[model samples]
Target chain A: MSWLTRAGAAAAVKRNRRAPLLILLLAAVFALAVPRPAPDHVPFGEQQNVETANPLLCVHTLLENEVQEAKIKRSLVLARELGATTIVQFFPWAYHEPSKGRFNWERADRILGHANRQGLQVIARLGLVPAWARPSGPDQPSTLNYLPAESFEDFARYAAAFARRYAEAVKALIIWNEPNLSFEWGYRQVDPAAYARLLRVSYEQVKAANPDMQVLAGALAPTLERRGSAAGLNELEYLSAMYRQGAGDVFDALAIHTYGFRDPPAAEPNRERLNFRRAELLREVMIAHGDGDKPAFITEFGWNDHPRWTSAVRPSQRSAYTIRAYDYAKSNWDWLESLCLWALRYPADLLSYPDNFTLVSADFSKKPIYFALQDYSRQRARSEALWLPPPLDG
Target chain B: MAAAAAGWLKRPIALGLAMLALGAIVAAALVAIIRHAAPPDVRTAFPAGEIVVGVDGSFPPFALDDGETLQGLDIDLARAIARDIDLPARFLNIGYYALHDALISGRVDLLISALRVDPARMDDLRYTASYFDNGFVLITDADDSDANFDALKEARIAYEYASSAESQIRDWEEDGRQLMRRPYELPQYALDALRLEQADAAIVDATTFRLYQSAHMDWSAKSEFISHDPYAIALRIDRVDAWKLVDSALAALKESGELAKIIDRWL
Candidate 1:
């Protein structure tokens, strides 16, 4: 217990007290010196310029849940190889904005970037409400497409954010798809006026964000139900109701889904039957409303070749009818902008009639219809060049 | 004196470090024991003597509801499997798309609604050996000499349009062989064409061919299987004991001739 022992203990205490501080300082220096690895660069910020002979040629691509970037790139590449200059891709709001006021554009950016890189114009459909945006009444179930009327402004903000972000790359945006169907309209009674109001709000917000962006409305599902029916209103009757509710002024163009269930494209258009020419009935509604000058975009249309589906046609018939539908639209419907088919491919097997609508299989194998469409597009391109007059000498 | 003081100070610090290391070692050992411990046996998750089976009741001849009771080949086969495994069968009608979800969510112990073995979903579920082959087969009037694709050259072959059979026929055509392909909207019509002497033979799936043969019983099928699509029972991958039981039951059914009798009842 002498003074020597006491001094040695005191010095040891001092050294030990400095150890933690010294270690922390060295760690901080190391951390600051070593830089973090950069994330893989995603190409963006470029304008998409697509050129093709057939302006009416387009296809819907399922890229929202496509996990692989290579698959997304391949889908767009194959579409372009098939002479399709435009594609209709779904950009679900719930997927992009999972929570309130927060946005994750990682997947959206990859899809849009790859699509733009492949020289394809994307007609982006925006819908699907996040859980937080849905209504919370005792009777209200949280559904993907259910958005309370109070959350319309929040939805508009999302649309505005999207339009502002992709303003350079994408020039067209569709607002809320297939509202005429009860299943699509949150399983509530189909209301054309409410949808028109939704479209008007979205159109104003999108235009404010990007004036150049074309706002598309009325991607209505084709049904034969009459007024007061529970399933849905007839698409023609729904369009008339939309015009009655002043939807004609809010949208730049009308977007219609023209699926020819079992009939060919040349099948006569009747209010009772669903056919490719049913698009004619939709156009007639626009003309009646004096909005005929605005072009119509057939955003979803095709024939399914499912062997078991009652509505499906034969595989060969599907291929033949699809090409004839394109030719019919080009020769007969001058007011049409594009005839994008139902789908190009899905990420996995839907195991239903819906899977049969795809031009390419889930495994990336091209179907016979895909080859048929490609050949048709090539021949049409050649015919178009032949029809073009020689450039006048300067 | 300084050295003695340092020694006294080091003793407590060293003691504290040792205690911390000991605590970490004890914590890691406890964690390992808990993690590697055997989980509760899923085989006994159901009722004491019953196995819950999920079936898509809409697929007729495989699984169907006659508005009161579920009856079909899949139902009888499931019953037979349950009997072999010494468990009572409780069938839960589920949609085709929700079958996998029902199995994974523990709503059902087994799925036997003519489930096809999907390689994509193999990681999530284990499948028993195939009990039925719904593959494409070549059928004739029991008097034809052409027994295979190579022999079917220059022969009129009838197939359902837009069907897997048509795709196979087209593949043969692509391989430099010519087939007088007559397409029908329904497989029954194709077989009818073959029976009516309009076609030399018919290429159709085994299911359609069996159903047609059940009614006619005069048509004979060639032994060559053109395509392979077998139906097997699907169980959750984590149910190790349950999978073993089902696999053994399927094998026993195959060995005892009960599987053939059950299939014959429907076919």
Candidate 2:
């Protein structure tokens, strides 16, 4: 070697020998400072050879002269294509039990009957009080919105009876759409304690009728604002109060409704604060009640076509959000078992109108949301194994 | 010779120890200075420990308040923001309008009240990214023929005070000037003004208007969100540091795909 290079090598060896302790200490610190991989989660639910992972899809029945069995079959097929193993169908009380005691299960029979045959699950939402249920007034107006305030018990009994008979075909029941809402509760005023009582009664009766039946409490519409005459409670406070009033143990799953403005699932620009991590909130309440591990069902959630629903997503956006939501729910398999869109099709009168919350047109033409679901279903069908993301922490 | 070499290594170890001690002292001093310099940006701007975020708990199929608890797009979004930053979110009973002041003077850190950021309230406060947006809609008793804006011009327009709808109406009035006659605020003093039929039509948010229209026979609706403004997280303009922190947190949220997940929970 050259004399200069040999001298340099000797100097480096001397420098290292002089600070051997320092070098060892630095190495120890570095070892401790390195990050470790996050822990993995255990999967839940029916992870067997299922074709679709998503368990909920939006389906609607347009007001018609006659209920079409063909349309029902198409919807089932559509739901199957949309990666949904479950379909949320509205059972408006006005149409079903038009009069007290007397029943007309014709529409439900067709819908639920068909859904059962297709091996798809059905979530039966029971609401829309009939004229006979309303309290008599001096200016006797026969509006279906009002229930015989006293007949709430009778209604529960009827509801339980309905659950008993259809327990085999349809077990999931979402009571009274958005009862926390003033308009949904007949727009006169809201009483949480009263609603809790109703929930307890219905829950008990349904459970008594069929213990195997899954009873999802009514999906509370989101309206934390208590402005003007349109007063409503925040979901957390409402649930807290419900639990306080002993409404916690009434149902199998907590049903929630979620929707965002025109932004995509990734970019919820305007209503970021309003967007709720659906399963997490319910889980929190459940934990508070010492039932943290209970599953949550998103009974009604979808983007609105309302070009101006203050924070509603656009038509294109609706599809993106829907897909992302499905993907997220699938990824986070536990806690969330179902997420039903608000609607499948708009009634003819509301078509082309704002706040258009539908997957299909009045004439049954599919929207982007329909196609998005279909694509997801196809993907799920192709995959041999399924993996979902870990549960979200708010 | 061995003794001399050992001494040399010992000297280097001593020197390294001294440098580390000096570095620790400098770090402590720097931390003290930073703590004193910033002093927690939200001390007065927003309530320090805990604050309430008012939301339309249930405007679902958009926002759903279970009468006591709040969950939905606005509710989930607020919770996520709260978690990222250091705020314990306790939703309050204060309605949509009451929360604005709460945000202004520390009663609350921010109003996740699903408020639309428009030109009218440019002076009130600062707004974060538009989380959600829907068009303005006119909801009326179904029999009422004045569903569209033109037909509803003659009908009395109803809207919440200080709401986005109020601001939009004001903007319209300003543009139209005297030619467009002003619509009455209705009921004189807000006792179920719309319910009392003081206004033939109410200009409400799309989700709400549609929900009412769908659920009630007395309601018919029409909406056009062509100029749909997005809902933004409202914060006081004076709290620059807190605002920056919130913005950064939100940016992180977007990057992590957490924001998208939040939207999925609600929408």
TM-score of 1: 0.63
Q: What is candidate 1's local distance difference test score? A: 0.81
DockQ of each: 0.05, 0.01
What would the per-residue lDDT of candidate 1 be over residues B1-267, giving only the tens digit for each residue?
999999999999999999999999999999879754744243563445688999888666888876699989999999998887777999987656456756754557889987778787888789999999987888876666645656788788887655567767777889888888877756677887777777777888787788888898655655457878888999878776787778878999999999999999998
- Cα lDDT listed for each candidate: 0.81, 0.61
Highest-DockQ candidate: 1
* Model 2 chain B: lowest-lDDT 10 consecutive positions: B182-191
lDDT of 1 at A33: 95
Model 1 misplacement above 4 A: A1-51, A135-140, A380-394, B1-217, B222-267
The stretch of ten residues in a row with the least summed lDDT in candidate 1 chain B is B38-47
Superposed by TM-score, candidate 2 places the C-alpha of residue B47 at a distance from the truth, in angstroms, of 47
TM-score (all chains, Cα) for each model: 0.63, 0.49
The i-RMS of candidate 1 is: 18.0
